[model samples]
Target: MTAITINFNNVVKLNVDQFYQLCRDNPDVKFERNQLGEIIIMPPTGGETGKCNASMIADFVIWNRQTKLAEVFDSSTCFKLPNGSDRSPDVSWIKLERWNVLKPEQREKFPPIAPDFVLELMSSSDSLSETQAKMQEYVNAGVKLGWLIDRKTRRVEIYRQGQPKEILEFPTSLCGEDILPGFVLDLQIIWN
Candidate 1:
C-alpha cells in the first residue's frame, strides 16, 4: 500500500507534543508530518526493501563504530526539523558534537536537530516525486548530505546543501564524501 496524506490544517492543527502523542498512541502505525502539518501514513516496506535497508544501516553502523565520529540512527528514529516537519530517513547520522549538545531528555524523544547525513531507500509504494521532495526538505533543514537510492530505476540522487542535486545511474558504490569522512557504501548488496 502507498502512503496516505491527511490534511488537518482546516480543522485541528496538531502541535509537536500532540503529534508525538499520536505516534505514541499508535505504535503499529508509521506516521510523518509535513511542514504544513499534514499527516502522512506510510505503509510497511516489502521484504526486499527491508533487507536493503538493513544492509545499508549495517554499513553505516560499522563505519560509525570504527570512526566514533557520528551517532547512527535507524529508520525508526524521527527528527523534528527546523521547518517544523518530522522526518525519518531510512538511515541517518549526526555528528557526535552536535548530538552531544542536546539535553538528555531531548535525546529520549524525537531529536530536535537535523542530521548531518541521511539515506533514503525507495520502496515500491513510494512516489518518486514525493521522495525527491522529501530529500529536498532534508537539505533545507540543514542536512549536510542526503542520498535517495531508487532500486527500481538503479539511480541515486545526491543532495548537498547549497548545491543542486546530482543524479547517478547504477553506481557500483557511493562515497561518504567530506561529511562522513572515509566511509563508503557498496551498492552490490542493494542492487543484486
Candidate 2:
C-alpha cells in the first residue's frame, strides 16, 4: 500500500467510537488522526512488503505465551479509540479480568477500551514526538503500561501508571515488570 493515500476533505471530526463505526461501514478504508484532528488514510495492503514488524511481534507473543504470559494481539487488527482515532500499535494486550467484562458483541469488535498494555514499534516514517503523544493518550485513557520500541536506536521507553517513564538502551533487555511479571523481551532479537 502507498501509505495514507486517502483525501480526508470535509470529513467532520469523529469521536473514537464513531470512528470505529465509520471503518466498519467503509471496509475499504483506514483512518487515523492526531489530537489536532488531522486525518489520514492508507490503501489496503497487498502484502508487497513481504513481512513487517508486526510479524516479529507475533514471534514475541508466542514466546511470551510459552512463558505463561497471555499476550493477545500483534497488529493483526487496528483499534478505534474514542477520539476518532484508529491506530495499529505493534502489539497490545488486556488482562483477563478486565477483558472479560465486555459483552459478547463488544468483544467481537474489540471495543475502544484501553488495553492493559500497548507497544508501538517506531517505523522510519514515524515521528518520535507524535508516537510519544500517542503513548501518552493510551496512558491517560487508562492503559496500565506502554512501550515505545525504537528498533533504529535499539532502545525501549517504558511507561507505567502513576510513575515516571523509563528508557532502556541497546545491549539491554526489556522487562514486563509489574505488567506481565517476570516476562522479558530480549531487545537483540527484536532488532535482528
Best by lDDT: 1
The best candidate in terms of TM-score? 1
> Which residue pairs clash within candidate 2?
4-41, 15-84, 16-81, 16-82, 16-83, 16-84
Q: Where does the lowest 10-residue lDDT sum fall in candidate 2?
A: 43-52
lDDT for each candidate structure: 0.96, 0.68
Q: lDDT by residue for model 1 over 32-90, one digit each (tens)?
A: 99999999998999999999999899999998999999899999998999999999999
TM-score of each: 0.99, 0.76
lDDT against true structure, model 1: 0.96
Q: What is the lDDT of residue 164 in candidate 1?
A: 97
RMSD of each: 0.5, 3.8
